[model samples]
Target chain A: MDHNKRYEICFSKEKDLGEFLKEAKGLNYSSFVFFEINDVLDIGEIETDFRVFKGIEIHKKDIGDIKSDISTYRSKVDYLAVKARDNRVKEVLSKDKRVDCLVDCFGRRNDFDYVVAENCKRNDVAIEFNFGKLLRCSGYERSMLVRKFHRSLKLVRKYGSPLILTMKPSTVFDLRGFREFFSLIKSIGFSKEDLIYSNNYFKRLIERNCEFDKDEFVEPGIEKV
Target chain B: MRFRKPSLEDKKRYIGFYIESEERLGRKEVLNELWSTGLSFLGEAEMAETGFWVHDCFDDQLIVEVRDGYVDEILAVVSLVNEIKNERVRLDLLGVAGTIRKLKKSFILNQEK
Candidate 1:
């Protein structure tokens, strides 16, 4: 593996796709995962020189709705993320292997229990750490967010749950280079190697999805060559 | 003057980084804001221990000198600085070295490329 390469798994609601792609190249991001793609934003019309992956974020009220959204969008998108705000939603998302990631663990009010962590490990759903919150929040809120992340990190370590690092950039301003992203997460007790592991998880996710899309692919362990 | 012991000398690290923004920024502006933000994020006691200094600034690029073991804390503080004077900006790390010579050889020389 080319260890120098860094992958950004989430960039959301980009206004100018073309410009963002150019910037992404300059930043040396090997791959980018853009969320909430629509018809107006044509992926084909734009360039695909960089490894770009499409993802849909599920922000629903209940677990049932989240599951439905995941099922609906799973095959269509390269990555699928659920915005887990509370324990109930987190629990529901964690138990499902189809769900790729569970994000927003440090929302205004959220719960991250050991059971949820173990569930994520069991089901292979990665827990996301968005550095955008660290950039945006300050004072007491930022401290609380850091503490929450620490708690989550501890649980993740204990349960061996996959951890993914995303900038969660809404605008170009929020976009950060790999080193900056690495340093920020490193400060939060995430080692550089952990960041690499998380990115590899996303890479594997994309590869798995691509395999399923192939015509010869029949089922798990049964592919028509 | 008596020669200072190597062990007694502060084991400092030179970190090379650059700022990305729409408009060009003066060195003073970037340095001042970095210090202020560092103070705010790390507070007085921690900031003092960090011994952070803007050793050099050219164009949008800056080389910051910080004591060893405090680089990550200083980096965390720098990441928190998203905006300066209401202008959006990002501080990206280039490389870190124990001495200025190596840092320049690696980051400064290749910065143009």
Candidate 2:
């Protein structure tokens, strides 16, 4: 039976595009989202069955800086992810419609709560869950991190925020198959339907971003005549 | 030790998973990581109660047995293990079944192919 297996978009900074593509293909991912546009050049040179997309991840401490950065990089990248260093910046960016993804909620603290969840839902900003965190941490800190993720997931569910699962792998060694990812999240309390939704969300993001890149597309709702 | 009746015994689930890595890992390394991760996360007392076992281990794929209610915990432990002997690795879970026979028949054959 066909399981309708999900396609993963790995965010990698690894310089060797050929090796990265080989690893990603082995992991069954059809796409790789690079953190910078420069790394994406060699991707075109390598003959592969994977689609590469440029993404910009900004780490900002203030809302003003974030707003300016978003404006500068919004049209330049296919995916715009923000790692808010301050809780206030996170709150503002979570509610900002221009922000595509709000990641690294566990940067300094467990930055998720009912309020942030609500804002993300209202703005349609995706709440990203990175499995790489679980890989790095262990013992008491890991337990606490798991609890924080559980609590955040509860709030995200209650407010109905879009959920995104990412590996954020820096190298080929960090890549993982979709089933491995699902198993991790499934243990964290997400249902099978939720897993399916996460996959669909990534697929939709790629499609939407591709549409936005078109010259004929004027904006979210407008088009050139 | 007195054996419990079949109905009195706890129901179990078998999880089929494969290790994703370039280097081939031995069964010992896989078990070591599994126990280390499981013990660190769930603690020894809780892990013992889960009745975890490596039902079968192949070159790359393996089937782990766990108590019905504790499958999630086992999954958490397995997924958290990204390294073994300082080598990077990833565990991709294929499927879970009530019986090892069923799990193999349904998932193992397909994966082997």
Candidate 3:
């Protein structure tokens, strides 16, 4: 599958949100997902907008779950955002269909169904792991984090869709195009085949969610072997 | 903990550090200088009475605790400046003060990558 086919941008601030929405409009990206931290004002206001699929980060209190705060937030969000401590909470939230994506901050766990393995068949939920931050983390922390992330990916593949790779770049300097992204993933232990499948999965999600006139999009020719 | 006066070199580093000062140097030169160095800038009431400022900097995401009487506070500022200069280190200065004593070298260097 052509890696260029899949694309989704997560925006954390209001300014970036406005900028990306405008850019997506011009580019006519078929599907886009918007994530906002729950504290941001006017979160409910964005839900009505058709330009993007909206996901909000809600704390554990908002979701009525005693799991890790991060998992509670993930459960309430359209895209579940899990931090290092929230693995157990994420297990409970995965059962809900409202969660279309699961973002693991430390890339520790990958099981899409059941808190522990052997509960049910796997289902696909988009998973994102940040290589840049992991690389900058302490050597011990990085190795431990990556090992967990890889394990998560294996579990996801066996139970659900393969893991989705993301850079989670907080600043403009962190941005990388498709080629750079593929190379980075390779450096971080993803095989060429895994990279290709991850890209295809993301593209499919975008196509499934984004709505645009067929004529406006120049389908990047992608082939599956 | 017994307070140790900062060495001249430490003082120089604290005073010369380039942080945004609150106002022109006047009645509170030391206070303003500390504030300029990006200390808490606790306002007159907080500064004269408590000798600390409670302000957030670095795009307002960090919540720092600054006490005027504490040399560790100045040292904390120096550490923050160094960490910010090195992009790879992700220490939240404000969060640090809230969670630990600002003066402990180990506390500042705990997560330095």
Candidate 4:
């Protein structure tokens, strides 16, 4: 609360994690969540001055497969994300409190409307703003990506949904410090208040998920079947 | 060494920065790319007001001079510059100061040595 919004998510599948963590810490991040599950990439024993969490991202396309994967990996991981292309599947994941984030894999055909954004807000599921592709492309490709992001940002702001901004870095060089990251998002129309809102949401997400061992934990807005 | 009145002169800032690259880059290439990227982000009119200049750059330690009230625009421009000559790079802010002397003393000098 006293400091900047210095939390991040690294989706790196590479093994050069030592350099990544060093760059992250040097760039003034206080905490980071890694969304890869490989045991070989473990940095638990590494003497780091920042917090790191193990997260799992489910890429199942079928609705049934997604539900199964969420249940299977929900408890095993500190954070859980699902990529759903079907609107119905997106709705299902939005309504499911067990899911932490919903990754928008649907490309330029952008399917995230006001309804999806509102649903995510109602369910507390965060929408990711991945700048990896943006950084990789140039000219027309980058322009189109920026246009797509503007549309998503408009909906996210209107609905007050929990939003997470990340570069989706796969390497140390791909990473950016908090200042640069914030500036990039701000250029896309994200306001300072939006950044603060995101910071508080992450704090809450981490606080609730910290007690993962207990069975009594209940996600807000969930009802008994 | 008669100088113009302080109030009549332009107020500029020497902002310190660093470029982390996959390989060493030339001064002209780096500035050319930065100016190009900065122009795209700031547009022609706003960029003219910036009075932007790459005061000195060595071993990726960069110091840029810009007009006042445009610091965030500079940061945003620097942030958007992800590539230079097809090499992926990251630009980070070191600090901001009113003069080159203080900027070197505070941000770049110690790190370089």
Q: Which candidate is the best by DockQ?
A: 1
After superposition, the stretches of candidate 3 with alpha carbons farther than 4 Å from their true spots are A5-8, A14-32, A39-53, A59-84, A105-121, A206-225, B1-113
Per-candidate Cα lDDT values, in order, are 0.80, 0.77, 0.42, 0.77
For candidate 1, what is the recovered fraction of reference interface contacts?
A: 0.57
Find the 10 residues in a row with the least total lDDT in model 2 chain B: B104-113
> Between candidates 1 and 2, which one is better according to DockQ?
1
Question: Model 2 residue A63 lDDT?
Answer: 74
Candidate 3 CAPRI assessment class: incorrect
**Clashing residue pairs found in predicted model 3:** A6-A203, A30-A210, A31-A210, A110-A152, A122-A159, B21-B36, B42-B53, B51-B68
Residue B40, candidate 3: alpha-carbon lDDT = 32
Better of 1 and 4 by TM-score: 1
User: Which of candidates 1 and 4 is the stronger one according to DockQ?
Assistant: 1
Tell me the lDDT of model 1 at A134.
Answer: 77
Per-residue lDDT of candidate 1, residues A25-74 (tens digit): 65657887778732112355667577777777777777777777777787
Off by over 4 Å in 2: A1-3, A7-9, A26-30, A37-42, A62-64, A107-110, B1-13, B22-24, B68-70, B94-113
Stretches > 4 Å off in candidate 1: A37-41, B1-7, B98-102
Which of the two, 2 or 4, has more lDDT?
A: 2
Give the per-residue lDDT of model 3 (tens digit) for A39-86. 322344343223355455444432354334444453233344433236
Per residue, candidate 2 scores C-alpha lDDT tens digits across B2-101 of 9899999999999998787768999999998899888987789989999999989997899999999887778777878888888888787778999989
Residues A92-205 of candidate 2 have per-residue lDDT tens digits of: 888788788887786546467777889998888998888777788887777777787788888888888998876677766666666666667777677777777777877787
Q: Give a tens-digit lDDT track for model 4, residues B1-113.
A: 99999998889998898888879989988899889887776688989988888899888889999998777778877877777888878877788899999998988876642
Superposed Cα deviation of residue B53, candidate 4 (Å) = 1.7
Ranking by lDDT: 1, 2, 4, 3
User: What lDDT score goes with residue A206 in model 2?
Assistant: 72
* Model-by-model DockQ, in order: 0.60, 0.49, 0.02, 0.56
